[model samples]
Target: MTEAPGQITAETPPRLVVLISGRGSNLGALIEACEQGQIPARIVGVVSNRPDAGGLGFAEQHGIPSQVLNHRDYPTREAFDADLATAIEGYAPDWVILAGFMRILTPGFVDRFTGRMLNIHPSLLPKYRGLDTHARALADGETEHGASVHFVTPELDGGPVIMQARVPIVSDDTADTLAARVQRAEHRLYPEVVRRVCSGEIQWSGRILQADGTPLGAPLQLDEDTHNASPPQPAG
Candidate 1:
């Protein structure tokens, strides 16, 4: 199983170390894709700040190594992130992904990884850059909402945008419903973004991101109903 001679290889598919803190549905998506020979990366390990995170179970079930560094066990955020970096670095991952990981990273740690780390946020980004993005978008009367894949920087959700898939803000959409829809897009978008990252199809240089052979352009505008004219039901 040899991958193309790019950023990743079959023997080493840009070893990924995922960080998760909850249901890990996105983590599960990544694992499933890897098992099915979809993405050009492999999960070297999974890390969580909470031991009870259900994603840890998913990783263990798939035989992917996992670790927990309880934030409560540390005295300060910097100390905890330092330990987290140490543990994740132990696996020598080419990239680190935040899959539902709910911790604000320190500039020092983010600087360490720079363009090698990424995160998935459930909003169009630059629109809603912080927590509760789903509810925030709806409350703001946004016409469309979606997920963003971006380089993880020191600023909260302020990294260079990579890819996004839009979902309509229907008349009856609620935070929960919109969130579910966004998650579905996330499952597809995150893996594609990871593949691009690992294959070198996408590159982050300075403050811009490019795909294939050229610049991807500024904040992408997306169609609310991409596959179907009618709004798709939220994932149950």
Candidate 2:
């Protein structure tokens, strides 16, 4: 495990195991923040479900160890998650972060970790909880779209949210355009959420999420855009 870039003079930093499956823009943000003394956590290792994921390169560039456990290699999702659990446990991570891991984990695996896991969903969550969130939101003519960082549970995106950043869906926005904006929010929100979790400022109870014991903002329900300063709306 490499030392996290930031110094934690006041508290102990959590060791992190990050999972990724794609371009890894959010992972890059976290690595940069940790390296720059911004986030208060050590990235113990990076794991991916795809060997070709670009996040592996990002981790390698920063001198962090990276591993891949391809889901296709396993006989079932449960088996793959089991291997993943074993690999992550070997590193003894304090936090398991799903940066962009595209797989849905089993309840057994999620239960094993308890409140130790975190994930960022592209939508505000409790809304468009599954895949293709941006496109789905656009197709639904939603005015606002954003990113959320929440505790991971067996029920997908059902855990309480820690933090979020909102981006209005402009009328001209395509799924690609909207996704770029949401991704930027995800990049910013994930690092900040990680910092808080590592610093003991936030708590994940597995059932409810909170910041410093008080639930942060409103609940992360999707239909209302609870975290937005100015929610996006359908074009008049």
Candidate 3:
């Protein structure tokens, strides 16, 4: 039998196996970060549940190996996650990055990679945990919105946040507009978080700790708004 392409050997930089379910914009950011040495690790493989996922193309474009494991083929969610775990572990990844992987993972799967999986969510988290985050934020008349990088836990987006990039809400923003702006922030925020983890500036020792050995306080912020979508909204 042919071995998978992502098997980690004794000698290699930290390996990452990224999971995506849609356009690979964030995956592209990660790939760029790895290739440019901004991140000291490498993405050994990209896996998606949807074969049609556009991110798969990004993986192919970069010569990185890609695989698709359709959930529809499995009778139960647990079974799918089981096989998914097998495939991911096959790579021997140091980290599993969920860029836009849209699945509620089983507790068993979460336990298998505890402290080693990271996910980037669209909403600030503790704000909008599931779908329709952009529209919901606009409906609530919120002034700020952005993305968050967090450790993946069983509670669906309830995991502890590690960092966030806050963007000023543009007055003219529709859901699409807001989502686009936030995604740009994600491109920046996610890579920085991974870079920190890979470089040991951030470590997970039963809990997240900073380079100074201080517990990560309030999730590091990239909150400085270098660009205003509209004239900035006044602080509430």
Task: List clashing residue pairs in candidate 2.
Answer: 6-37, 143-232
Model 1 clash pairs are none
> Mind giving the per-residue lDDT tens digits that candidate 1 earns over 4-121?
3237755667788899999999999999887787787789899999989999999989999999999999999999999999998898888889999999999999999888898999
Candidate 2: lDDT over CA atoms? 0.79
- For each of the candidates, the C-alpha root-mean-square deviation to the true structure, in angstroms, is 5.9, 6.0, 6.1
Name the better of 1 and 2 by TM-score: 1
Query: Per-residue alpha-carbon lDDT of model 2 for 107-152, expressed as tens digits?
Result: 9999988787889999877789999999999999999988888888
Give the alpha-carbon lDDT of every model: 0.82, 0.79, 0.83
User: Candidates' TM-scores?
Assistant: 0.89, 0.86, 0.89
Model 2: weakest 10-residue lDDT segment is: 227-236
Off by over 4 Å in 2: 1-12, 216-236
Where is model 1 more than 4 Å wrong at Cα? 1-6, 219-236
lDDT of 3: 0.83
